[model samples]
Target: MVKKQNIPAKEKIVSVVLLAGLILFMAIVIGPGFSEPSSPNQNVAEQMLPAGWSAVGGWEIYPKGRLYEKINGREPLFDQYGVVRLRYASVSKGTNDFEVYFYDMQTPDGALGIYLANTPSEFDELELGTLADISGGQVRVLKGRTYLEIFSLAEQTPKDFLIDLSSALVETIPTEKEARRTAVELLPKQGRVRGTLILNRENTYGLAKLTDIFSASYQQDNDEFDYMIRTISPSEGRKMIAAVGEEIFEFDGEIIQSETNSLVAEFMGKTLILNQTGDFLIGLYGAVPPDQGRRRLDQWIETMKDQLHGSGK
Candidate 1:
C-alpha cells in the first residue's frame, strides 16, 4: 500500500523546475544531434600549427582580389580553380623552418582541381585529407574545400614534423563528399582507373576552348584511351565538331560525319570521336580504328547518360 502526502504549491513548482533542468542537462551531455562548441575556423590555421611550431609573423590573409600581392604570377592559376582566399604563414620548429600556405578553393572540386593540376609526376604520397602529395621537401594536401602546402626552408626536409603539422590542419576541416562524388558521378564505374578523374576548369587537353571539363582514362580488354565529358548545348557541340574538323592542333585530321550529329576524326595515328547527348558533350581520344572508337565512345556516352539520370549501376 502507498500513502500520498499533499505537497505545497511552491515546493511542487520548484521540484518540477529542477526535474526539467536535469533532463535538459542530460540532453546536452549525451544526446543525438547535439554538438560540442568548436573553435572558430578562420584562425584554425594558427590554433592547429602543431605542438612545437609557431608562425613567424602570424597568419596573413589574402583574399582572391589581393592574392596577386602574395603570388603575382600564380594567382591566375588559383583564380581559375575558384580559390576564395589564402592564409600565408612561415612556421619554425627547433632546427626546421617551413613556409605554409592554406587555400580556400570555395568547393571540394576546386580544391581537388588545383591539387591535381599541381601534382608532380614523381613523388611520395601521403594519406592525409582526401589525398596528399609530397615532392622533395614540399607537401600539398587537398581536404574538403581547403588545400594546404608546407615548403621546407633551406631545402631541409623534415618529413615527420611536416606530416604532423598537416594532420593538425586536416582534422580541423570536416569531411565533404563533393570531391569524392565528382569522380564517381562524372566517371563510369568500370575501368575508370579509380583516382584518375580530373575536374578541369582551365584548358583541357591544352585546348583553350575546352574548359570546365571532366577527364579520365579507361582501360578495358588491354585497350586504353582518354575520355572527356562536359556540359554543352547541341549548338555549341556542333560548333566544336566543326572546329575540330578544320584542325585539332598539330593533328591534321579529316572529320567524317557519323550518326546524325556525331563526328569522327582520324589523324596522326590517333582517332577522335565526339557527340552531343542531351546537354552533355562526350568524346574519346587514343582509340584507334574509327569504327571501334565510335563503338567505345557510344558505350561510354550511354553510361554517362545513365549516371546523369540517376540510373547508373
Candidate 2:
C-alpha cells in the first residue's frame, strides 16, 4: 500500500564516497587523541649508555617528593626554578661509575635559572646548546627545557668517559641552541667574573618582589664584590623603588636620597646599595663605600644604556 522510492545509482555512489571522506577526516583528526599521550622527549634511557658502558640500574623518576631527597636537601633552590621532573640513572663499565641527572625544567629560562644559581666553574664550552660548563670531573649543559648534569660517581672516573656520555645524550635529546639574548648579556664583559653571572629567580636578598635578578662578581684590588641588576618594566620600576624604600626602613638602614633613585644600606657587615634606573633595579653588595659603589654603579648603568641603544632596546 506504500509507494517505493529508490536512489539513483550515481546518487548512491556519491553518498557513499562522501560518507567515506567524512570518516577518513575524522580518523585523521580525532583518532590520535584517543591514544595515549606521548612523552616529552625520546626515551632518555635508550640513548644514555655509550659504547663502553652499561646502565648500572633502571631509570628512575623523581617527582616532587623524591627530588627533594636526591639533591642533598636543596629542594628550595630547585623549586624556585620551576622544576617539573627529574630523571636519573647510573652507568658503569668495569670499576668506573658515572651518574647522570636530567632536570626537566618547565622552560628554558627555568633551566637557566638553576644553572646560574649553582655557581659552576667553566672548563670547556660545548656546541650542544645555549650554555655548557665542564668542571670538577662533571659536565653541566643547559639545552632548551632540560638541564643535564653528568658526573663521576667517584672522581676516579675518566673525564673523557663523562664527555662521551654527555655527547651521546646531547645528540639524542631534541633541542636547538637558544638564539635570544638574555638580561645577563647587558653586563659588560670586562671585569665580570668568569662563569659568575647568576640569575636569582625569587626573593633576592630577602626583599619581597625582588626577583629575576642577574648578578655577577667583580674584582677591584683583588677584592671580590657582587653587582646585580633586575630588569622590570618601566611601570614596575616605581614599585621596586617603593618596595626597596619600605625594606630599607624595615632594616633600619639609611636611604640616600638622590636625583637617581638609590639607597645605601648595611646588612651583615656589607654595604648594599639599590638603584633604580629606567626599567632596571640595580644593587651592589659587599664592603665598597657609598661613593665607590655609586661610581661603579653609574659606570655599569652607562654601559648597559650603551648596549641597550646599540641593540635598539
Query: Cα lDDT of model 2 overall?
Result: 0.71
Residue 51 displacement in candidate 2 (angstroms): 6.7
Q: Tell me the whole-model lDDT of each prediction, alpha carbons only.
A: 0.72, 0.71
Model 2 C-alpha RMSD to native: 10.1
Give per-model TM-scores. 0.61, 0.59
lDDT of 2 by residue, 114-158 (tens): 887774545766656567777777888877778888888785667
Task: Give the backbone clash total of model 2.
Answer: 0
Model 1 scores a C-alpha lDDT of: 0.72
lDDT, candidate 1, 16-57, per-residue tens? 999999999998887643332222344555676777778776
Question: Where is model 2 poorest over a 10-residue stretch in terms of lDDT?
Answer: 304-313
Task: Please name the candidate that would achieve the greatest TM-score relative to the true structure.
Answer: 1
Give the clash count for each candidate.
0, 0
